[model samples]
Target: MQTEKVTQHIINWLKNYALNARVNGFVVGVSGGVDSAVVSTLCAETGLEVLCLEMPIHQAASHVNRAQEHISQLKKRYKNVRDAKTDLTPVFEEFKTEVSLEGEQAIVDMALANTRARLRMTTLYYYAGLHKLLVAGTGNKVEDFGVGFYTKYGDGGVDLSPIADLMKSEVYKIGEYLKVPGSILKAAPTDGLFGDDRSDEDQIGASYPELEWAMQVYNEGKTEEDFTGRKQEVFKIYKRYNRANKHKMIPIPICEIPKNLK
Candidate 1:
């Protein structure tokens, strides 16, 4: 990818969207990952107001530190960039408790983690509504469509997806061009959703590079592959992820009315 050209292209898209929508600014939830860093920087480059929120729900200190560092750098570099930290742990705990109370069993890990994301989503849209800014999404091509790792209507909820077309590896390339902090640029990618500091790969079953390759093969209609060893297993895993998350990745099925009934 052409770093400079891609950078300018995204900036133009942001500006045009804001102008057409009559929104004065952008609201991005920064997770201290390459995707967020690159996207927030691109929004800042548009010379429009950018509100970056560091929302931690029982977050790790290291993740918080990286978020602070990235926001600090953006604030220094761009006058329009504004950032703040919000801890949603209490809210999430209460929400989880209420949900579990409805049922005898406690909330499951996946359900509990999804609540954290939806809370952050609510926070971002709150600021967006108050400030009249669009909610910018940080999802990349690989995770957005490859495995559907994001929670539906949670982190997946956004006004626009700037990097949704670019893969995770491509996001890193743009991060380098944008001078994103080395600490964050080199750090492993994580959603920072759960208490355990599990990297994206830890949950995805393969590295981003490997997943990207598998995604390419899947997209290319090249399904005939050996499924013997670890490498082949990775490809098969990718196919499973794609099939499972297809629902979240596509539009919800709607009931169609028959003309005769009408």
Candidate 2:
């Protein structure tokens, strides 16, 4: 898709939604990654107040710096770029001391990583309430609807997802079209939960392009026909995470008696 049309579509969509909800602006967690960079630019183009938050733990200095750089460039184009950083190390330490955390170090690390995501979400909501801004999710279709590579109530919790329909590669295309900083566009995508070297592809063992291809096939109602190589691997990833986190996507269950029983 052309950058101009996509940009206009996003602006029109947000404007209508903002007016309907009586919102004054939009807020997004800028991870210094491509997805959030594109989202921030799109939101800013709508002439809405776009607040970008950089919530980093101890391991995100490099990513945070890149995010700041992107935000700086965005400010030149959009007047509403503001940043706030909240370090989550102290909060994680306190929680670790309170709870008897058991399991391997990997498990502990995963828990800490999830804590950081939930903290970011909480901070976004707090600002949203204060500013009457809609929380814009930066997750793309490949991650959100395909592999489900997100926390249950962490980054997954959002008022709206602007790029939910675009794949990760498509998100990069949009970012390039919007003239996002080359430093951000070229940076290896990571969640900044572990060290700077850790990445989602490292954890999932699949590339975004491959994941999106499998997703498109599956969405078109195709079954797993090939049982070899990356195809099988992608299927396993899709099934495992989808089945494991099914509860995350559903509402809490409740038991009730029939009204006539009374």
Candidate 3:
């Protein structure tokens, strides 16, 4: 994939985008995941002001530690990089108190998980506005396009996505090249939204490699019927998520009136 060339391309793209937009730099929500680590590092490479926000809401200890470690290393390596931590636990608790938690337990938990993401999104935009920075997205191809595994108006809310076109494996490759903290690079991927130890594989029922394979085969005009056993199961899982989360992958629906009606 011409790793060095790809890395320079993204860095130049980020630099040009920020310059064209007249923004100082970028603000990225670092979650200690490979995606965020790679993204934040790329933004730093642009040699512009990059703010990394660690907004945690009932986050797991391992996740928090990894996030801190990555941020620390980034700040040390890049003079333009700085970080801030906002403990959103109290804010989240207050929000829960104001809202009714009436519904199925699973549904309610899911909603709260999304709320955590939205809260971080809000915090990111707040800093972006204050610092004249663009909100840099950390989503990769599989999550952003293949599975739609992000919260709309939440983590999906961003001014620009630097890694959306790269697959998850590609992102890891970039992470390794960028020298991201070992703890983060070795950790299993999770959204950290549920405040649990469950990995993204647990939630999606498929690993990134499996999903990438399914995405490729599906895009190549292969159907679930063409596979059997585990492959079929993975394909079905990918298809289900793609269908269910199509709303996130496409433009919002708008009602268009007929000319006569107008």
Candidate 4:
């Protein structure tokens, strides 16, 4: 589908969902990544009130700056766009202290990093409830379903998703068509979870493009055809991540009731 058509379809989808659910607007966490940028802009295009929130929890300065720039542009272009921000550093620090124990600093950091995402989720819900809006998620296809890179019940927890069907590259295409800032389009994608400031590529072991290719090949049932070099390397990486994150992508299992008992 063309970028414009896809964008319009998403806008219409969000509108119809809100109408059916009886919500007045959309509340989205603007993480300054391409997915969030595109999703927030699409929310604004629906002509409903959109609360674009910047909830930074000791996030990288560059990521926070990009988020602010995108929000400013949205506010200028769309009157319904509302810019809001809440710094979660203090909350994160307090949680860190509460979770701290001797000789477990690395474990503490790992748990706390995920806590940041959960905290952000809580903040978004607080604003959404106050404004009577649906929480719009920013995760794209590859991250949401393919690799499951998001924090479960964190960024993964949402009322609705606008760009979850599109791949990362497709999201960039829509973002460009929507006139996302040139700087943001060029900026490296990061989840802003780790304090080391690593990009998504650094954590994922393959670029988005590479991961997309691997997903396509896997879906095509070409996993058994082995090859050497980067293709083989990407295939391996994809399998590892996809398998490790399968739980996150799937629904929680439940025991089936016995027919006699039913």
lDDT score for candidate 1 against the true structure: 0.89
Candidate 3's TM-score reads 0.99
Cα error, candidate 3, residue 78 (Å): 0.6
Q: What is the TM-score of each predicted model, taking all chains together?
A: 0.95, 0.91, 0.99, 0.96
RMSD of each: 1.8, 2.0, 0.6, 1.5
Write one digit per residue (lDDT tens) for candidate 2, span 64-121. Answer: 7788999889888878777666766787678779886788988888887788788778
> lDDT: which is higher, 1 or 2?
1
Which candidate ranks first by TM-score, i.e. highest?
Answer: 3
Question: Global CA lDDT of candidate 4, please?
Answer: 0.89
Model 4, stretches more than 4 Å misplaced?
Answer: 101-107
Taking the tens digit of each residue's C-alpha lDDT, what string does model 1 give over 116-198?
A: 88999999999999999999999999888898989898989999999999988889999999999999988988988887679
What TM-score number comes out for model 4? 0.96
Candidate 2 accuracy as lDDT: 0.82
lDDT of each: 0.89, 0.82, 0.95, 0.89
lDDT of residue 194 for candidate 2? 72
